[model samples]
Target: MIISEGSLVLFFFNSDKKWLIRIENEKKLHTHLGIIDAGSTIGLEYGSHILTNKDKKIFLLPPNTYDFVMKSQRTTQIVYPKDYGYIAARTGLRNGSKVLEIGTGSAALSTFLASIVMPEGHVYTFDVNEDFMSIAKKNLEKSSMDPYVTQGIYDPEKIGQIRDVDLVVIDLGDPWNYLDIIYPSMKSGASVVCICPTMNQLENLATHFFHGGFIDSDCVETFIRKIEAREGKTRPSMRMIGHTTYLGFARKVLK
Candidate 1:
């Protein structure tokens, strides 16, 4: 499809250099490679190419949900993409699924979930920090995910409004503490994932899973290292994301 005015597009220079932008008229984007005339991308089809001011070729690609997740603005550490797929698959999250996100850091994960469950499903995300919530709202709006997301400030009384959700994702400091409160709101066979940056937290959360009528509990941590591929010089990238967080996954069961 042609890149129309105000259309979101991805300018891919390399694995490390990518820019997500809306095609606004008279917009110029400066990069290390060269200056990109954002307006020039209009009418260009995805998979085509654009030339920078230095005559460097940049790939014009379609922006996907993952693109928005990585490009989302943030004040805090957002959930990494590596963990998103695992959580979705483990929880069976799909179209029309309802998700309760306890910590709306940057809305990166929220945007991804919203994209999958769009036009039918919804994500109710809560956070105590108003400034972070404000940033997340903008990120959600940028990805057009605001329609499927319900942003709310954290309040004990307001949480009761969420019920029968398919998935519960907790990213707070002590996710295990909220299990009792959200247990009634989770559907039978629903799944919960807690993000733990430390082993102690993971062990603590896992113990609660056993005592809280959750079955099939497991915890996993992932690391990703990009390979710098070049002719006769392909090797593992020195810069890598290691040990971002541990994901504790469990499914609710009725006693």
Candidate 2:
């Protein structure tokens, strides 16, 4: 597809050097390779190539959800993709599924979930920090997922208007405490996921899950090992993603 003006551009120089920029007229990109005018990409198609000022081949590519998540601006650490993939699968999140997310940290998971439910469904995310919500707004905007996401402050009254959600993802410090707050928003049999950093949180959550009108509760940690593959040498990467967080899953049931 032709890269339109104001479109997000993925200028890839190589495996290690790449950037995501919006193609704006006369915007100059300064990089180690060379300076490339963002205007050069306006009429070019993705998968097309342009030359940097120093004659480096810069590949025009498309950006995906992973790109948005990795490039998002944030003050807090995000729930990495490895953990999010499992959370999404366990929640059965899909197109047209309504989601209520508490604690929109970096909007990494929010953006990912929005991508899956866009053009049909929506994600409502809230956080107490204005700074964090500001960062999340930009992240979702950059990915063009902002339209499908509703972001707000962590006002209980503000969130009270949202209800009948298909999935609820709580990324708060004391997610167990918010179970009562989110419980009313979730449909019966809908999934609720909690992103916990410590086992103590999970243990606390398990107790709440048992007494809080939720069933089929489970907790898991996801690990992703990268493999270094070559023509002859194939081995695991020296550095890989370790335990990021534990995902707690449960379904809402009648009291």
Candidate 3:
């Protein structure tokens, strides 16, 4: 397919450096590799190569959900794909599954869930920080997942309007405090996932889940290390993101 305006493209230079860009009619991207005429990419077939001014070869590839989430403009720390994989598996979220997300940081998880729950389902994300929500809105828009998402600044704990949510994802520092507030909005058999950054938070959340209207509680911490998959030197990358956060999963049981 031909490249077009607003199309997301991935420019791969090497394993260490790759850029995700939104194509525009009149734009130039300056990088350490070279200056690339973003407008010149129009009409080029996907996977085509363009030579930069500095003779650097730039290969253009269509970006996927993972690329959009990773390359999204970040105002805060985002949930990495490794954790997302576990969350998705634990929750079994899919198309037509309504999701409620608290603490829409950078909207990475929001975009991921919105992409999966398209055509029939929606994601309602709330954040107290308007600036963060604004940044997240732009990121979701760039990924074309905004249509499936609803962004708001109201606190999910105090909001009385949301109801029948299939999944509730709590990304707040004090997720346990919101468990009582989130319980009423979720439907029976729905799952609630919490992202905790510290052991203290996880311990508190565990205690809350035990007392709250929840069952089958489980917790996990995800670790990801990318390997250099090259011939003769295929091994794990020396540097890796060892710890991001802890994830706690539980199912809401109806009274």
Candidate 4:
């Protein structure tokens, strides 16, 4: 497995620490282990180990969307992998599914969604903040998922312009505010997933979904805990990723 140029690579120091960077021969990387000449990595096989000047060993590994999200630059809070996984699985998003993503904060959700619905489908992500969109564009470009996503810098009030989407994902403080606009644009039986950080928002969202003619509504909070696998000392990790946000799911049902 040759490490290709422009490929995202991970230098794992340990389970807790790693560096995610694009393979650029012209650049050099500086870390606590020491400085690494990037040009030297051009022909190295993945899983190969290299020793730094300080005699620290590092392993080259393939990178994934999760790594990209964790390492990508962010101007706002991002949706965690745990929540995105649930959204993907529950919504049954697949290749060729048109997705409408509201609130393109850091593009983490869009990046993951684009990876799933590429070559045949597309994601139209909307945000009012041009600055946020600019950062998001960079992230998508870095992930090589830019071709699969269409980002626009427009006010959320203009969401009425979007139409015929298979899935609608809302990442905002008040998802209820857009329900009216989203209802007409969504296809029948289409799934709507909302991420709310507070109970006040959840209550408003659930109420709005019910009255807005969305059925099969369910709200769930996902928590993930990792367990240590050391022999004779295997136990749950002391620190676990917990309480990112509450997810609300519903299906469009025209009255």
Best by lDDT: 1
RMSD of each: 1.5, 1.5, 1.5, 1.6
Q: Which stretches of candidate 2 lie over 4 Å from their true place?
A: none
| Deviation from native of the Cα of residue 107 in model 2, angstroms | 1.4
Candidate 1 residue-wise lDDT, 1-255, digit = tens? 989998999999987799999999899999889999989988889999989989999999988888998998988998899988888888888999999989899999899989978889999999878889888999999999999999998876778778889999999989999898788889999999999999999999999999998999999998788888889999999888888999999999996
The residue ranges of model 1 lying beyond 4 angstroms of the native Cα positions read: 229-234
Model 4: how far residue 146 lies from native, Å: 0.4
Candidate 4 structure, TM-score to reference: 0.94
lDDT by residue for model 3 (78-115), tens: 88988887888899899899999989989999999998
Model 4 steric clash pairs:
none
- Clashing pairs in model 1, backbone N/Cα/C closer than 3 A: none
Worst 10 residues of 4 by lDDT: 153-162
Candidate models: Cα lDDT each: 0.91, 0.89, 0.89, 0.87
| Model 1 CA lDDT for position 65 | 89
Estimated TM-score per prediction? Answer: 0.94, 0.94, 0.95, 0.94
Candidate 3 Cα lDDT to native: 0.89
Candidate 4 lDDT by residue in tens digits, 53-110: 7878888988888888888899998989888778888988999999998899999999
After superposition, the stretches of candidate 4 with alpha carbons farther than 4 Å from their true spots are: 155-158
